[model samples]
Target: MLLAALIGAAGAVGAAPAAEPNTQVPAGSRHYAASGFPDRIVASPAQDAGSGFAVAWRTAPLAQPPLLELAVAGDSPDMGQVQQLRASSQALQTENGDSQHHRVLIDGLQADTLYAYRVQGQGSWSAWQHFRTAAAAGEPLTVLYFGDTQNKNLSHVSRVIRQGWQSAPDARLTLFAGDLVSGGDGEDDNEWGEWFAAGGWLLPGMAVAPAAGNHEYFEEFEDTPQERRVLGKHWPVTFALPSNGAAATASTTYWFDYQGLRVVVLDGTSALDLGTAKAQASWLEKVLEDSAQAWNIVVVHQPLYPLRAERDSSVLASEIRPVLQRHKVDLVLQGHDHTYGRRADDGASLPQYISSVAGPKQYRLSPQARATMKPTAEDTQLFQVLRLDDKGLRYEARTATGRLYDAFQISRDAQGGKRFSEVTEGRIPQRDCPRPVSPKGRDDRCWE
Candidate 1:
């Protein structure tokens, strides 16, 4: 069923059959409010970013058909010169009832140009928002990367995002390793609302590329809930991602080039399952071999090498590590352990693998983590800023309050190899917050 949904055959394969009509509905605010206006607006890079970009927004029923008006950013307000595009709208049933999801692709845009766009609701129009396109490859660029912001989306994670934005005001794009929300089934309309609330107005003008996490899959079947776990239904309809990936995992496992960097997003959860692992692996090798970009980065939810004490991702390490090493992938950004861990590749050109958490949830470090990874942190939420150019790459990880915890740089040689070095000279000491005590007033095994 999961594979079927990934390939857009959910209907034929049978979507998780509706069990019982949900009686308990959650409450949301602002964006989720049925105010007959467009909300939850977001921008994403198009497959051919040199001439295109995409936007998605939500509206209530009976609202005007979604319309987008766009023009090159200019001083004069020339309404006649602007172009309007109609978005494809789909009705999705949510905890807040039915709402329409609309997406529009603004193509034929010139590269490296600033453009202003606005969307229309039934009778209301959103204020204009602005976004810039990617400059050509080889040019210097800065991007922000985040880990699992699943829990406390509006309260805790929002601070990390706002802090990152304030720190890297010149960032061209944002990337999430996975788990953007705590709700996997997608029925938690309030959670998605909180996610948008957390981003506030920042996401509307930025191109965001996110990978899927295990939490993004909701078990929809009532008959055999344990066996059936497909992607949250809202995922396919919410974001307008590029459809150039593995046959079974297109939107969820695609690759795109931003300036000089090539980012490949993989469906790690699917790869753990035998049925889709081979296809994902084959597609990964092909994408890497065909790419000539200066920098190659891979983003996924699960780490190739697990960082927590109770977990071991032997399957991913054995199946995917060799290909990554062979291709000399520059960086691997991952999430899922609710901790911070960075491992410099041992005697390998692919020198950086970082697993970080960006939400409130924190886990105790595994005993083996001390031997495998350096500059590790527990009870810490982090966001990393990466700057890439012809010289090399610089990365810095900071806490929500804007305190540096880890930093590093990778120098690229003339022959395309990389030399890694730590740059954490004066960062905050590693956080090892004690586990919460139970009602019995005893130590939690997490500390053990």
Candidate 2:
């Protein structure tokens, strides 16, 4: 269902069922708002940043709109400086008895400076939240990347996100490849809470840029005759984002600059389902051409390089990779495949491919692809900590317990030649093993 148009600083939008308008009367089914509290905060400002940010939250039908406040820092031991920071407030409600809300864009923030804020509803505003603005051009910075954090999220999501931060305490930004939540389940209430609970305030701590995954694509199911997009009410209004650059009515697909890095965010669902493929492709190409940042990273939900047979149908592989190669995109971070993979296509003409999974699950790599990737260890829950340098880049894929699974380095020469090198000197155990024996079902001799 298309989330209803958000209104005012605190507005609630309704989710119109895909293919069918929700016929159920919005005024009746009064559960009486007696069960629990609806507290959520998601940040994604629409296009035209205008040096502004958008905020969204959820609440009970009968509850009063709380005092939503903004601040400069979060949970400071030095609360004495709260007055020194600037702030704002607002309120709202959705058509389906759901209380939706928004906050004023805490205006006039210093570029690349720290700001703290908070929310109030049930009783008082929650803890003070914090985030920073993008740095000026030509500055080098580090950003965290993750793919497929959907399954068994509550039990395992925190370990991976916090662990990544633990590894790089000062990472400038956080980017998610896709499938933030399992689509089939939690299509209704509790998922958003778990997402925020798992990561807690840490997600809002840094500038978060999440690519749209299949889970994020909720609206009328135009493809199927009897289907409609469901429960997508939480996406647009829950989060606050920079209103600078984006395409279309929604800012779910937008781009931002962080420390000389032009991080482009695109929605795979839009490219595949909507006829906006050409429009997005042209915009992406233009962004790449116009961007002079030292590093240009593109983050999306789908993978160009597939690890499983099911993942082979990548629309972007045909539609997007050509543009990336043409524009000299530095990195492409994506999810959907639940495995650990880092393959630099020595064969591809330009740029490099580094795909990974940071989840509680694990996947086995094929020994057949060893000609280039050389599959060594089998780890389901692994995160890559990549450090970009002028010379090239260094990547370390580690297990949740902090075990190093794969390590590789790429050094670029002045002539623009890239050198791929593997890590043989980590504290972790060595995986320099041979390929496993073939199964009885196939012939190993005449293979790919």
Candidate 3:
């Protein structure tokens, strides 16, 4: 495994766990505390085509406004023609402390070009970091897809993300199926800190496309008659996503195109329980109808067909499924079931559904999973790498230890029809929990 090799060679150290979920922040804990140096820097796709993108970062409150220095990457240490741009800042109060989040949307750049940028600290400038723009049309694209990293983020999920990045170092974008953190209240800044620390320096370069999960929303005023659910406070400051989605949930739902592929992200938690189903459904139909890309993919937190019986959502099946079917989206990536489940294309339809988890949390598979899902697993963490080229779209799912778990390819024929074929020759055996010989403790199931 990449992680094992790196650790053995470098004697790397793991991140210390942050504060427990929804707990009080301990005194003198610098794990999540904001400092003068910038941190949690991330890049996101802009609403426009491949010409522009957005970058965001956080730091301790600054007396003077922050600035961003940008320049086209060149061979020498001396950066020529550097452009210093002012960034917009937002003051935020969190349990970790008061901090400022800054964002800049850079535009009018050459396609398929690399650029270096750095942000101003309190009295110093940050180290130069580099990011590449989306390639021109018809260029092959590679992307990494990850399921819920909601628990044990720093301790366990860190290795999964690192291994995925090592496996696909040139991937342009990373799609996160949500429930990114265990706490929904959004007040636990430490959880967000853990998530950022888990991704480390890798987050600043690659573009991120994330969907909001139910855990991103939490009930306010608990035990009161006026209690209500609201999205976490950290989301807006953390991600500078496109605002071209449905009116009701525009902040969490959006779309971006890279090369010949278009990625559409949705807020399933808001649609199912926040009275935005009709609005999202209407917007989804319009987006799909207007899409011009060769390949289209939809990302949402809840699955249309869940692996566990209790986790099923009828609203998703009714509202989202029809739009996907009508538009013939190539793939639908989902999470929130805490297991791995996939339904390959049936040859007549276009989309194939996949739901997976990347954290340590596990849940028992539904009884029908064995009959319905060709390959399924419980108590396993996996990440997927997807490559899109002229021949077709190739997808491979690998375990946290870098072993190939599942793989398939979706290709188009001369008649423009799609076909699905699995790589069955060298795939490892399907992972499933062993049936217990006798009941023990309070439950008979293998998962708690």
Candidate 2, residues 3-64, lDDT tens digits: the string is: 33333323444322122111111334433221234355554322222233444555543344
In TM-score terms, candidate 3 sits at: 0.90
What is the descending TM-score order?
3, 1, 2
Better of 1 and 3 by lDDT: 3
**lDDT assessment of candidate 2:** 0.57
Q: By the lDDT metric, which is better: model 2 or model 3?
A: 3
Q: How do the predictions measure up, each by TM-score?
A: 0.88, 0.73, 0.90
lDDT per residue (tens digit) for residues 178-252 in model 1: 888767444467777778888887788988899998877765564773576578766777788888889988758
| Candidate 2: segments with Cα more than 4 A from true spot | 1-38, 42-56, 61-97, 101-104, 138-140, 218-231, 242-249, 361-379, 389-392, 410-424, 427-448
Looking at candidate 2, the ten consecutive residues that score lowest on lDDT are 16-25
- lDDT by residue (1-448, candidate 3, tens digit) is 9989987775557532223333233454646777889888888887654787888898999986699999999989999999988888888888778999998888898888899999887887778988888887668899999999887688778999999999998898899999998874444688788888888877888888889888888888889988777998778888888879898997899998888888999999898887788889899999889887778999999988788766657898888888998888999999999889888445544578899988866666797766778789877889999999655898898899888888888897755577878877667888976544212321323432
Q: Every model's Cα RMSD, please?
A: 10.6, 12.0, 5.3
Assess candidate 1 and give its TM-score to the true structure: 0.88
| Top candidate, metric lDDT | 3
**What is residue 149's positional error in candidate 1, in angstroms?**
0.5
Report the backbone clash tally of model 2. 37
Q: What are the runs in model 1 whose C-alpha is more than 4 Å off?
A: 1-31, 62-64, 77-80, 184-187, 222-226, 436-448
Candidate 3: pairs in clash = none
